[model samples]
Target: MRSHHLLPLLLLCILFLAQCTKEEDTSPAENLMQEASKISYTYPALSTEPMQKASTLTAAEWNDLANWQLWTPQLKLGAGRLVQEKWHFALQHRYTVVLTDSLHKRITDARITLETSQGTLLDESRTDNNGVSYLFLTAPTKPEDLRLKIVYADQVFYIGDLNPQNGRIEKQLNIQRNVSPVMDILFVANTSLATADKLVYLQKELKEIINKTKSQSDSTLHIRLGSIFYGLHAGNSVIRTHPFILQPEPTLLTFTKPYTTVTHSPETIDLALEEAIYRQAWAKNASSRLLFLLLDTPFLQDPGTITRLSSLSREAARQGIRIIPVSMGSMNLSGELLLRSLAIRTNGTYIFVTHPEEGLSNPLSTISTYTDEPLNNLMLRLLVKYSKLN
Candidate 1:
């Protein structure tokens, strides 16, 4: 009887130990799931009503908006440039170079090199389709010490030995060559289920703008419009890209496609942004490269996502691609921070769609109030007068 009792007790203790080991093995995964749940739970519901008045931002307001310190602390991890004081000062000292033909027409695809009198190359950039290039000089580097070497259409031009003070400098180069201004605008849209309704509104606004722009016959400005639609479905990111075209009808069709097949997962914004940055067919010698990102979803906050975004922003800036992020719905904290970071990083502007139902014309009127000039013309004016470059 004593042996039988001891055998049963031994088996019972073994089973108890096995159960404890199983719990220990699953605890980490369980904790991760709980944390994810908590994050989603804390997110506020998407707002149905407009949150802000539709108005234009002044130069002072734009500066405040670009300040990264005003954003959430989480943004600081990926966007180090915005937090650096040196980088901010460098932006202020930026100089603009505009190359034009003797007839005043812009020259495209011009290679510009900035160097010291000693031939130490400081920085170099190619003129965009708009015939614009930007260069920066740091402390201890006087404007008189700077020299420029420009190569365009197999001809080389040099300009140097100048005296410039602490204020902004705008240099004009009248090359012997002439090229028409080419503008390429790429519209990126999020097609996730959460933002389905906003997509409809965006399509209407885009159609009106496209028609209005096309109606204004500015032979000097050549405009090509394209679009990209992105979403997540069946654990995969789906992206459809349309190349820049002079016609708008086919490009507008993409915005009408239904996204009901999307899975329960949130949008793959990182992949969408990556596609917008790399896969699009931007004109090589175009004068302007503009990317308008429209979305209502919050981006993933994972480290990998943030790092990728940072890298993409830098690349876009290098390519002279301006990214304008337009918020379609009431903005959330995380969404606003990420959008603003991208805009600021690429030296682009941010717009909030306070009243989608009212269309983007009134809100964007500040961009171009004149019907004859249209949006792109106004954009160029803003670049010259306010932002100072395309």
Candidate 2:
């Protein structure tokens, strides 16, 4: 009888111990997946169409095509230069015009050309609904008398100070760009532990953007640099005193005290937009207005918060403020989804600074992917997205 009782007790203890071991083995990753799952929502209402291109648009326009108001009619903006044998450019519009009849039909098959002052044609292209594409080129020889001409059937139009619109064209044409151009950008970053090293890498990259744009000869991302570090680790979080104009911090910023914090939430982001951002007059009008977010939190976590985030995103889009998010550390489903949602809603881009352990890309790309050099890809995308490069 004693042996039987003792055997049952022993087996029960063994079973409990096995259960504990299983839970211990799965806790960390399981928790991550659970959080990610909570945010794995499919928002069918969100627009996935390409944004209305202005006179200038990058090859990579963040996939939002509805709701927001993009600057009039450009796809890509900025400038290009011929350095050595290669011609590099961000592709800003020098002049733009929409061809339409009284019936409001877009002239899709029209021919557009740019010519030298001496009537020599330089570049000729066709038009889509958005308008004709005209890019500025920094040739080795800075020749004067560069002019533009448009021909639709028998109608002829010249773009210059003295030239007027062709009788066939419907609207008055001018060289119009975006309301807020990304040439001058404001960066907001999370100062969490996982983002510490990543922040350093980004700061270096930011310097590259600043240097490239600052050249009087070269144009794009050329603005006075500024950053606002947000999170628990940030010491007394200082908002910029003079709008988005802070001297670029040279040293790599590190907040190495690991405390797995959630700094990127809807409230925090909304506050940043209200105080740190929208206070500027340019918030309403610039050629390319862009906001770069470096963080682990893509957006809000809870449903209530996410709803608020949607409103904020729409407002940002209305103001032409594109919110580009770059996430660091372990990629979770929730963060990725929310981030992509924010970008799409605001007509922006989402950059994933993912580390590969299993080393594979999620089919949706909202989840993490294993990359050899994530930064290089990020930089290229940034150039294409923020610089509006073709």
Which candidate tops TM-score? 1
| CA shift of 145, model 2, Å | 46
lDDT (10s digit) by residue, model 1, range 304-390:
676677668766766667777865554544455456667765657665543333222221011211111122222333333221123
**Candidate 1, residue 356: CA error in Å?**
6.4
Tens digits of lDDT, candidate 2, 32-109: 332223222211211122222211111111232221123111111110011111222212222334555444444433
Candidate 2 runs further than 4 Å off: 1-182, 213-222, 233-242, 246-268, 281-284, 297-300, 356-377, 388-390
* Poorest lDDT segment (10 consecutive residues) of candidate 1: 363-372
Alpha-carbon RMSD, candidate 1 = 16.9
Q: How does each model score on lDDT?
A: 0.53, 0.42
Model 1 regions more than 4 Å off: 1-93, 98-132, 135-149, 158-167, 248-252, 256-268, 301-303, 332-338, 344-347, 356-390
For model 2, give the 10-residue run with minimal summed lDDT: 76-85
Error of 1 at 132 (Å): 4.6
